[model samples]
Target chain A: GAGVSQSPSNKVTEKGKDVELRCDPISGHTALYWYRQRLGQGLEFLIYFQGNSAPDKSGLPSDRFSAERTGESVSTLTIQRTQQEDSAVYLCASSLAATVVRSSYNEQFFGPGTRLTVL
Target chain B: GIQVEQSPPDLILQEGANSTLRCNFSDSVNNLQWFHQNPWGQLINLFYIPSGTKQNGRLSATTVATERYSLLYISSSQTTDSGVYFCAVDQETSGSRLTFGEGTQLTVNP
Candidate 1:
């Protein structure tokens, strides 16, 4: 089975430029998430999508960050007017389901990640 | 938001040695997972043990939900085991959102 996959393993962007990172979740995964990991830092939650329900945007650090998951397969995280502070590795993960009951036992499979470097 | 903490921010061990990594959370969680991020920054899922114990090859993990903590054990470590180990938890109130700990950096010397 194919694991989750992300595009443009590495991206160097000028500050204030926008960038779009893409993720393809495993077939049938009902839950998808985005996270950012800065150098020598832990991962910070960005956004999450569960089925067709409203996405959880509480974790998005600012309005410049937004994510969209089409159906239950592909997801894109876009950063408008990127800042140097936004430079980090963006990771995508997916699971079988999003409900707490099902998520209790379901392991989230992560993608290789997209490294965004804002200069 | 739930807080997650990992112990021994960094560790160095000779190959074949065994080590234990700990993760303590401030609140109850519905999901707890262990991940290994290799030198290349690829996150590999190690375990999804929110409760009880599970082992795979030389790695094993146990989570005591009631106690609000989990432990990951690696035995007979190899140079390839040199990486960062992270513990992430999804608090009951956060639905499926995972809060990750700072992670433990492990260095295995031959």
Candidate 2:
């Protein structure tokens, strides 16, 4: 089975530019999540999408950051007017949703992640 | 919002040594997971032990939900085990969201 996949493994953009990172979740995964990791720091939750329900945007740092998931498959995180602070690795993960809970939580699998550098 | 804390922010061990990593959460959680981020920055699920205990090869984890803590144990470690170990929890308030700890950076030398 293919794991989660992210595009633009590495990206370098000038400040004030717009960048979009794409994520293709595992087939049949109903839950998708985006996270950001700064150098030497832990990952921060950015957004989450489940099935056809409304997405959770509480973790978005600011208005410039937004994410969208079409159906239950692909998701894109767009950062408008990229800033130097946005330079980090954007990781995507997916799970089988809450329906199948072998344990108390849905185990999430991650992608290679996209490293964004804003100059 | 829940707070997660991992002990021994950094650790160094010789190959074949045993080590224990601990995670403490500020609130009760229904989902507790342990992840190992490899050198390539890919997060590999180590355990989904929200409670009780689970063992896989040389790794094992135990989560005491009532105590709000979890422990990950690695025995006879190898150089390939060098990476960051993170503990994440999904508390009742967060409802399906996971709060991650700063993580423990482990370096295993052969």
What DockQ does each prediction reach against the true complex?
0.74, 0.62
**TM per prediction:** 0.96, 0.96
Q: Could you give candidate 2's per-residue lDDT for residues A17-70 as a string of tens digits?
A: 999999999999888898999999998888888874545779899999988888
Predicted structure with the largest lDDT when compared to the true one:
1
lDDT scores of the candidates, listed in order: 0.90, 0.89
Chain A only: TM-score per candidate: 0.92, 0.92
User: TM-score for model 2?
Assistant: 0.96
Which segments of model 2 are wrong by more than 4 Å? A98-105
Model 2 clash pairs are none
Candidate 2, RMSD to the unseen true structure: 1.5
lDDT tens digits, residue span A16-82, model 1: 9999999999888888889999999999988888875546888899999888887768888999999
